[model samples]
Target: MRIVEGIGIAVLVLLAALAVLFLRRLVIARQGGTIELGVRLSTMVPGRGWSAGLARFAGDELRWYRIFSFWPGPRRVLTRRGLAVERRRTPDAAELLVLPPDWVIVRCINRQAPVEIAMAERALTGFLSWVEAAPPGESTPETRPYRYKTG
Candidate 1:
């Protein structure tokens, strides 16, 4: 009977410890500004019924320029002129555009610059880091593919 009581107490302690750890993880993730893609939109409202379905499909098709580390963080929307002179111009001079969450339009400023490669690599790496740092029991997508539409 004593042994049973001790075992129960031990189990309760272990459960409490686990709960603390789980809460700690959530707090850290929130503080770190880590968020999963497709989970929330920082800008445009979600469409209704059929439109929402189409929007989802559109989202699936639109190529992700980058997976930003923080949601709704500072971003730059490059213009054609800006892109053309990206390599030549100082990084500080470059204007960053903070886009609406639902904005799928990606315009390249420079036809010859390495922006696409750089952006893609950064996004991929950021996503991998997010996955690695994610806490146990927190759900994440199994895979992400680069989807883009060409005009």
Candidate 2:
């Protein structure tokens, strides 16, 4: 049918455009010698699991940009305030589907909302240090690492 053919053509065109857009984002995020590491991020929703992508630590905020997204800027910016590290866990079937092998998940609360993100162990250490480091003479509850520890 003409209508079916038209629809298929439209879908193919859209996929092509999306592919180009995402590739542009990938190139842009890696510019200026920035360290863009692969990471998986997700909310605490039961059915909704992690979305694997790239993360670049830019100053006080951790910039989260999805891998397949067309947006040039980060979709989410995680700050130290209201950020709490929950626990580490091995990826389940759903997460394993997205994350890379040997990578571990670090669950945390981002701005009062529960979030889980996965990265390499070395990157995890860097993230913890980044979250714990505080500015001179301005110590807030968010800067304290011990607050995130659970019994």
Candidate 3:
């Protein structure tokens, strides 16, 4: 009986810790200019797939935090330079479980390496604009978000 009681207490402590971590993420995400953009780690393997997470915009970089991680730091930092969006695709039905509904997955180059990020269409436009926007004294070609043809 003592062993079982100890195990129950341990489980409750772990649950409380997890709840605290989740609440911390929510507070950080609620900060100004912080957007709840869903992201997924890209896999090059033909059979292996992706892992989803949430990203927060910090300054000029998008800091990707794993959804299940308790760590406070980002797993990956996506900067603006050398960030080329290769393509965008709508998520299929099965993917909906991993990604938000109707969100588009954007295949992009993160400093020469390929990475896939998923977010809402409007948020993607904002992301693209934020990434392409030039800094002071730097010349950048004007960019516009892509629009798909609909009938």
lDDT of 2 by residue, 23-107 (tens): 8766756663233444444355652556656677767778777767777787777886556677876666766666666776777
Off by over 4 Å in 3: 42-48, 136-151
- lDDT digits (tens) for residues 93-138 of candidate 3: 7677667776877877655477777788878888878766747633
Range of the 10 consecutive residues with the lowest summed lDDT in candidate 2: 32-41
- Best-to-worst lDDT order: 3, 2, 1
TM-score of 2: 0.68
RMSD over all Cα atoms, model 1: 17.8
lDDT of 2: 0.66
Clashing pairs in 3: none
What's model 2's lDDT at 20? 86
lDDT of 1 by residue, 5-100 (tens): 999999999888777655644543455433222212222432211111001112112222223222232232223221221121111111122322
Ranking by TM-score: 3, 2, 1
Q: Which of candidates 2 and 3 reaches a greater lDDT?
A: 3
| Steric overlap count per candidate | 11, 0, 0
